[model samples]
Target chain A: MQASMSCRPKWGICKMNQDLIQYLLRLGDSALIQGQRLCEWCGRAPALEEELALMNVGLDLVGQARNWLEYAAELANDGRDADHLAFRRDERAYRNLLLVEQPNGDFAVTVLKQFFYDAWHLAVLEGLTHSSDSRLQGIAAKAVKEVTYHLRRSSEWVERLGDGTEESHQRMLAAIPQLWRFTVELSDSDAVEQRLHAAGLIGDPQQIAAAWQQQVERTFDSATLPLPAPACHFYLSGRQGLHSEHLGLLLAEMQFLPRAYPDATW
Target chain B: MQPGDLIASDLGARAAAPGDLDQAWQVLGRVMDPEVPVVSVVELGIVRALAWDAGHLHVVVTPTYSGCPATEVIEADIRQALEDAGFRAPQLERQLHPAWTTDWITSTGRERLLAYGIAPPLGSANKRSLLGDNGSVNCPQCGSAHTELLSQFGSTACKALYRCCDCREPFDYFKCI
Candidate 1:
């Protein structure tokens, strides 16, 4: 049965594999981009403790990215490995959410971005734990534990900044409008996710979105920040490879080393 | 069948001779975690299983953290240790399911962590810790229950920075994830 499936590339099996690979890329690329953005705060964070926290969270994301990318490469059955998929791909080929690739504007902006992403991340990972794909289940199970801690930390920061001093509150207020539009991609799903979900290999988009919305609203209420109207009309879709200008710049710096030294190795 | 089941069946293809599995376990026991040299990987519960496959020793290991920098180093160390102990090119498999948790750390491992001045994970990693309520971590140095969390993240991904109020000393607490 396994041999027959492998030999038949034109069958539904190939199509399912392709969709699975795309979904994996979405998961992997989001983590890689988000981790890179967090690492940008390494030397410039406000305090020593904050610096460690940012880097630590960043490390976890990057690590998770590798796991997803490695699985994607295996299913791809192409010559490209995880490193090649991560560094060699151009901006349009990347599948990370726009929220992660956005530039780290300010402390308030970063915190809000993280808070929103963490909520969605936890929901998606928890759903993935029950996936029919055993490899994905394992990966998601591991990530859920780490992301649980991440969500707690980021949500606490949202509450702290939103309800703290006057300036802090104002900064968070400004951040809401700036980043809220990008979150449309979080709840939005396309054909790839639909196919995977139908195959029982991924989570239901509506359920994951509902859980995400509940958590975000709860946190915002506690933080005393008004829940902005849903920016559903926004059409930015990172999974479809439509990215903002910021992603190209970020990728330039990130891919420079590998691109410049294609043959270099440790 | 599940992928794990496939691995299990393959492992059953050739059972290890008596004492081979025991010898491999002993070799792995001597192989310590690179980040925390005091505790062996076996003690840390990262080494999940040892089996024989196709006349070669197969070892399965799980990383403590997803992006733990030490995972590669630890794998290499395990391979080197097994090879040095006369196991030929032992196969190393990285398993991600049944994720590594602090609870896996044996009682002896917890003692080693304490003696090394790192407070063991406080309590069971339950749903409560996921909700921003990590139970109080006691100080490893003075055995003080008055330790305060200095930072959610410490020197490593698996640790949180903490300070003992009584002794006024800062230390790392193995986070209960």
Candidate 2:
């Protein structure tokens, strides 16, 4: 059976040779959806400074999404631009991690989610900077800088809330356990990643996960939060466009303006 | 003039004077960034390449800030400015490789940023960003080194909010990346 033009491959198996495009979409969708989540906080963040910071970070990820998606469009050769790829796809076509799509439950939740994601982002990008693919290397190099700053900000918040007060600490503690399960899929390699890993175009998933583990352990230790045991049953498949129930609702809202008024320029 | 000489002369006349490349740079210099309004894109090192190709002018630009809101508008502005300066249908190619960095901002760009109340980056983006390194960043307002970070982000995506303790003036520090 032929894969649809818009939808990427199913998890653990992609028969098509369009590996680079698939890889790019994996990277792109995560950033794009993450950015969208942050945009949800545009006017609603706890403080004015936090509002500006979240929006800026959202813009950064969206920008990176544009970069990756633009390149993916070229590889896909389906005449779809970044806008179409972002706003026209169904949730089944989305390749973002489930961790990103999870609701921003509270400030504690946002901080924990961001800290976890940032560590992985920085580690993966750092490894990708040495990729045989020049485009991947360049994008990774540039992103490393941005995500470094992101990790710092989020981790500081993690520490602040963890060590702050009874309420803040309790909230952070509650936020971690629920979100920890989703991180398992982060570095769980599929056939696509395996092939790319062999070619030296993508980072080693194990190594990247290890780096993130070190960072997470350190942050949790400092935050005075207990590290939850890694999930025994990993929900192992967001990379192949398999996502949580949250994604469909997200795509509905994100695609609204574009779907309602086709070719709407904003 | 010989036939080849004639072709060259006609193309040159159509493009601009022999020094029109210089004139093109001048035109670029005058086109201020919409957001900052003080520094031109050329000064900021976003305009990477400018030349005549196949009897047409081609301008290559690397948009600064990965998802900077101003990327497209700035590109449009560049195209419009070049057309207004008589370089008709000049090609504009937006390249993304090696991504834009704060290090690319020229000394002139730094001065313009300072004058515009935005502090320039202290050093290279990579070095300043390594796990722990908050280098000395003197305030653009009062040239004070005693500045505190109010927020990681400022008025724009490329800046951080900083308040100068000495002058007590809040300012924007253009982030290294």
How many residue pairs clash in model 2? Answer: 1
DockQ for all models: 0.70, 0.59
The Cα error of candidate 1 at residue A116, in Å, is 0.7
lDDT of 2 by residue, A195-255 (tens): 8888888899889889988998898889999987775545446787778888888899999
Q: What TM-score would you give candidate 2 relative to the actual structure?
A: 0.91
* Candidate 1 segments exceeding 4 Å error: A1-10, B1-18, B132-134
Expressed as tens digits, the lDDT of each residue in A123-224 for candidate 1 is 899889999989999999999999999999999999999999999999999999889999988777888888898899888988988988999899999999
Candidate 2 residues B18-112, lDDT tens each? Answer: 35788888889998888889999888888998898765668998877787899889988987777666676667898877778878888999998
Candidate 2 residue A225 Cα shift, in angstroms, is 1.1
lDDT of 1 at B24: 86
The residue pairs that clash in candidate 2, if any, are: A63-B67
Interface RMSD of 1: 0.9
lDDT of 2 at B144: 89
What is the C-alpha lDDT profile of model 1 across B102-153, one tens digit per residue?
8899899999999999999867777686564766788989988998888899
